[model samples]
Target: MLYKVLEVPGIEYIVLDFKSSDGNFIAQDLDDSETWNAKAFYQWLIDEVLVFTDDGISGMDKDLYKQFKAFANQRGVCVCDSRKI
Candidate 1:
């Protein structure tokens, strides 16, 4: 399973060089965030993206996922755990 943390403006997320677990991380130019504008990214996250893993490990940890999903749901953030990837 691939796990990641996404930080908003005031928070700090995990950093990566190419691939990443941090939200808003750049795959190319580390500072070239303008290309990966957050609004569009978040929109895609809510509408299209999901916490999926190629090994079909997404949302496998049910208790934790459910707690986080509940938290996100309360805050109106999108957190999907409908099935395995």
Candidate 2:
């Protein structure tokens, strides 16, 4: 499964990009985007139009905890293991 992090204003989101059982590409924005597609998803994530999470993480489809831990390191966003929080 492909994964991405996004944010708009006061909200942060995690986007899960995957294929449906019917063989069609599907995108689900964790915080809810009814119009996002895989076509420009990467660009959106890279543009910094969305910021990384600094509080908590979402999206269980991917190993989001581990993924965000690394992401937080690079961006200086502190993230702790949920089990310990």
Candidate 3:
């Protein structure tokens, strides 16, 4: 998928731009949570974006959502968050 990474004041986000069938391009934000791994980010795309909500801002299956934390943990998703950078 084609996307862009943006850094705002206190947050970094991934922008997923989808062109609608009618030719309108809509951008969706997926909070990066500071993860920089391609594999982990791919999983985030599956677990957080695709599984939860296409727009990245809606409900997810409870069981699936609950498992994401553990999944993310195993992938070291939050490793960079507490770093001094």
Candidate 4:
């Protein structure tokens, strides 16, 4: 499987592209994207956009967190997480 993150003009949220089971490409807004095989768009957000600690503890990089919060607020999107709900 492959994943891609995209930004479309006139859209409030980011966009995502991935392959479906039928080998067709599907596009959806970030908040509405699906998770398959434990891989999701939020993983890209965490790995690329946000700074997080991976030492088996629930810790955040304060400065990066602040920046991310501001960015999310400005864009009207939620912060990165495994589950959006």
- Which model, 2 or 3, shows the larger lDDT? 2
lDDT of 4 by residue, 35-76 (tens): 322133334454454333433113443554566455444444
What is the Cα-based lDDT of residue 54 in candidate 4? 39
Off by over 4 Å in 1: 1-50, 53-60, 81-85
Candidate that beats the other on TM-score, 2 or 3, i.e. the better one: 2
lDDT of 4: 0.39
**Please, what is the TM-score per model?**
0.31, 0.30, 0.29, 0.29
Task: Write model 3 residue lDDT over 1-85, tens digit each, in one string.
Answer: 1231122112235553334464233334465335334444644454444423343223444444445445445545542222123
* lDDT, candidates in the order shown: 0.40, 0.43, 0.39, 0.39
TM-score winner: 1
Question: Residue 76 of candidate 1: its Cα lDDT?
Answer: 50
lDDT for model 3, please. 0.39
lDDT of 1 by residue, 7-50 (tens): 21222332334344543333222354433333334334444544
Clash pairs detected, candidate 4: none
Better of 1 and 2 by TM-score: 1
Better of 1 and 3 by lDDT: 1
Mind sharing the TM-score for model 2? Answer: 0.30
Q: Which stretches of candidate 2 lie over 4 Å from their true place?
A: 4-17, 20-24, 49-85
Regions more than 4 Å wrong, model 3: 1-39, 42-57, 79-85
